[model samples]
Target chain A: MIFYVVIFSILALLLVASGLYAIIQKDLLYAVISTGVISLILSVMFYLLQAPDVALTEAAIGVALTTVIFVITIRNTTRFEDENDNNKVK
Target chain B: MFGDYQNVVTMSVYGSSIALILIGLYGVLIKKHLMKIVIGLSVVDSGVNLMFVAVGYIKGGTAPIFSPSVIDSKPLMVDPVPQALVLTAIVIGFAVTAVALSLVIRLFKHHNTARIDQIKSLKW
Candidate 1:
């Protein structure tokens, strides 16, 4: 019981911290990475709760594929507005 | 922290996850950037996944597998339904992420920017 409680609380804290970082982050790439971390932690928490199936799915879909797609889009877009404007002049 | 031992902890964890979901929703509603919106969507997804996992935890539960040493012994086993549901949710989340990112990429390719304010085609 104690162990479960500790694990649950730790996972909850990680979720909150990662969510906050993702929301507050200015760089699009950074926000995407933070979101991936949130998903990865969620999968581990699922395993601890006796849900290996959910963990596997979350790891494969949320961590790997979603992060990849976001990185691809970010690579083709501007991270900051000011930098984009400077490129427009040249 | 309540009447029951495991139930109390499980409920607390689930409640916290719900709170995180709400925060993520707020981020989605308030953020103007397209990438931030995607981040909020992911945050919301994680919060929901946590709730699913918490629902499956059982106190002193053993693995669901049947062993030879316990022919007569009955052990507590955690629920498996929530885990399955969470797995489905994860797959759906990825599909949504893929589509959203693709839209973002196409939008950037045409407009040379990802900012919501810069895109005026749909706006009057």
Candidate 2:
């Protein structure tokens, strides 16, 4: 019982840490990758929570498809988020 | 309170999922880049999906499957309904993300920028 609690606690902390990392990341590509990490950890947690089906779906879609589409979009647009324009004088 | 060992596990799952949702909400609400907004939305989806499964999970529960080996352990199987629902949610989330990204691409093309504030002030 305590073992399960320990594992859950660690995974939970990791999830929140990665989430914060995703939000604060300056590089769009890195932010997307962090989101993928979130998905990866989530899939593991799903399996631990006794939902293998959901875990597999998350692994396939969240970890793979979502990140791919976002990467492709970033490739077409901008890799780094440009925040310099908000302060420019008109 | 973390007095009980079981509560720790349950609280961990619930707390983390909620934290993820909040972090994503912050990203969506405060971020200027269109890509960041999309990322935030997807994170929120993940958080919700996790919460769904967590809500359905039972302590020491087995996978909700029917097998001859476990003919008598039916009562220990985890709830399957939330799993099915989360499956659908995950797929729909993927579709939504694809559509959102495509829209971001279009916005970038039309406005030549991905910043939300800039896109807002400029002619589309």
List TM-scores of chain B, every candidate.
0.80, 0.90
TM-score of 1: 0.83
Please give, for residues A1-90, the per-residue lDDT of candidate 2 as tens digits.
Answer: 667778899999999999999989887788889999999999999989988888898999889988899899988988887656333522
**Tens-digit lDDT track of model 2 for B1-124:** 2347867787899999999999999999999888889889988998999899989987667898878877875557788999999999999998899998899999889888888777665444
Off by over 4 Å in 1: A81-90, B1-8, B67-74
C-alpha lDDT score of every prediction, in listed order: 0.75, 0.87
lDDT of 1 at A17: 80
Query: Candidate 2, clashing residue pairs?
Result: none
- What does each candidate score in C-alpha RMSD? 3.5, 3.7
TM-score of 2: 0.92
Worst-scoring 10-residue span by lDDT in model 2 chain B = B1-10
